[model samples]
Target: DAGITQSPRHKVTETGTPVTLRCHQTENHRYMYWYRQDPGHGLRLIHYSYGVKDTDKGEVSDGYSVSRSKTEDFLLTLESATSSQTSVYFCAITWDRGTGELFFGEGSRLTVL
Candidate 1:
């Protein structure tokens, strides 16, 4: 275990609402990532951070945003909730970006109705 934690393991909200999720780690890894798991898309990256205040958008980052103010904390926010955005989100950490050995936290499931 890399001391990763995700808040609000499960959540339900109405469409058009705003939702935020938090991911915290104690490992001090250099890279942190947010991903959404869907049936057909598998695990799609939403955002990632390589260092404090250094972040970037990923393949499926249209309605999502991420912030990394510290090396151990990464936050993900959904600007406006949508039924299509309902999915299980996962937070992952990796020390070596080239090796791609990611340690994942328990997923956070979000539902929009």
Candidate 2:
């Protein structure tokens, strides 16, 4: 509640266009993640960074990519947006690794037509 923000909260794009969503956090947490929430699949991770410059692909990373150049910012880019990629994106940060509980940003809604 104190340290999270997402950009482009709502967007509509054409298929094959490039799009990028930004997540900003002031918590200075070590773990940050990008996830997509769909009707049936629920929340699935697209990518995550444990620390600055340390990133890894997640379960749904096929159509997405991410980068973390600084401690406070993480970016998710859809190189080529597709209709199937339409969904709500969420960013989360964790202060402790053991609990696995994350504080989430409101969300970024993207619709690909």
Candidate number of the best TM-score: 2
lDDT of 2 by residue, 1-113 (tens): 74889999999999999999999998788899999999989899999999899999999899888999999999999999999999999999988545888889999999999
The reply for model 1, stretches above 4 Å from the true place, is: none
Per residue, candidate 1 scores C-alpha lDDT tens digits across 32-100 of 999999998899999999899999999999999999888889999998999999999999998655588
Worst lDDT window (10 residues) for model 2?
94-103
- Candidate 1 lDDT at 58 equals 94
Candidate 2: C-alpha RMSD after superposition:
1.1
Q: Give the worst 10-residue stretch by lDDT in candidate 1.
A: 94-103
> What would the TM-score be for candidate 1 when compared with the true structure?
0.95
State every prediction's TM-score relative to the real structure. 0.95, 0.95
Error of 2 at 60 (Å): 0.7
